[model samples]
Target: MQPLTKLLHFGYQQALSSLFPVIIFLTLAGTKAIQVPGLPRYDLILLVCVMAQIIMVKTGLETKDELKVITLFHIFGLVLELYKVHMGSWAYPDFAYSKIAGVPLYSGFMYASVASYMVQAWRRLDLMIVRWPHAYWTIPLGALIYINFFSHHFVYDIRWVLTGALFVIFLRTMVYFTVDHERFKMPLTLSFFLIGFFIWIAENISTLLDGYRYPNQGDTWELVHIGKISSWFLLVVVSFIIVAQLKRVKGEGFANQPVPHAKDRNM
Candidate 1:
């Protein structure tokens, strides 16, 4: 394929893979703008997200295994949300019957959307990792990255330390994906950063729609701190590691796929 056509095809696939997340963002904006007489915005968002998930499954857009992975992320995200909200890092200011401890149940979908994107992109792009590190290296790193999110508030902040460790661990890793009939490769760490950056952008959009509010936004809405890219970057690392491990356990052997040659034109 020509370079331009290939790029466009890649973009199309990416957008398709992000369909679920796109729906969530639209729901947030839509609910905020057009409130129901009796329904809370958060509750409405929860309803829409649940309906969207059901549709995705019934329509075969999401596989059963993918649903399982997405559910895991939902749990992880909700736990973090509960802790962060309690710690006053951020809050769900709106009232809803579906809320638990001040967080709307819909909040978990935010994290689930990230996993949804990963699994969809993996299948759509035929993603494979080259030179992936062993589980021992990746699992512990992922655990610490997640732990540091909560622990940093009470104890010493070890985010920078974990970030440095991530670089070293994934230095040799490369993500290979196909666009159109051509194959391309990029550093795995770079992919994590790119995904994180885009999520940061989405975070800004979500906050603007009152999806959730950071303490700074209580009075007025402003751009989320650029430094949040680091947190999102680390979160993306944890998400990627979990997805990779799940894929590995399902018998997609990590670091086993041979790199495709330039002459190969089929996906």
Candidate 2:
């Protein structure tokens, strides 16, 4: 395949594979719209999500290790979702027997879907990193970012400071991914911004579909505020920090080998 065509194919696969959970949610919603009688919408969504995860694993779309990552995000995100719904960050905004503390059990899959995409992309794209920091630095920052998502309700929001810290730490880091025979390099920070931007777009779509509602959304649909990109960007940071560990980098490289140079794209 030509390089451009390969790039497009890579992107299509990444978007589709990573978004399996979202697809299932939207599908269950459609089923609910058609007045499926078997289960409530939220419960139906939860069931479909679980089935989707199982299917993905069985089909080898997600590996055991990747499944572990998805499980981690589900737990982490569910706890945060419970808190955010309580604090009115956003809401499930629908009736469901599966609701706990006003947040649906299905909600965490939305977050796990992000990790799903990360691990899938990592494996499919043959991803590698340049100038990655040690685990000690990233782990604590990831923890703080996750913590601030909750603590900011009472304490100060250090997200901005943490954003600066991300740049400081990953400033020199670059991610190398393959499309066809060409190897491409992107700044780690830029990749985070791009992913966050797309997630923001997904957020808007999710809200428009009534997957959830924001404060500004109600009687009519409203575009998700661009400012939410900052929030998503930080969450992306946390997600990336967690998934990057799976690569087991031995240096500024991948698979324990040194990264290739820009001019050396024959890989």
Model 2: how far is 147 from its true place, Å? Answer: 1.2
Best by lDDT: 1
Give the alpha carbon lDDT tens digit for every residue of 132-229 in model 1. Answer: 99888999999999999999998999999998998999888888788876678888889999999999999999999999999999989999999999
TM-score of each model, paired residue for residue: 0.96, 0.90
The CA lDDT at 89 in model 1 is 93
Error of 2 at 76 (Å): 0.5
Q: Which candidate number would show the highest TM-score if scored against the true structure? A: 1
lDDT on C-alpha atoms for all candidate structures: 0.91, 0.81
What digit string (tens of lDDT, one per residue) describes model 2 on residues 1-267? 576796698778677666675675576458546755766778878888888899888988788888998999999899989989899988887888999999889888899999998888877777777778888889999999999999999999999999999899988787888765567777789999999998998888788878889887977989999999999999999998877776564232353344654433522
Residue 252 lDDT (model 2): 22
Residue pairs that clash (backbone atoms under 3 angstroms), model 2? none
Clashing pairs in 1: none
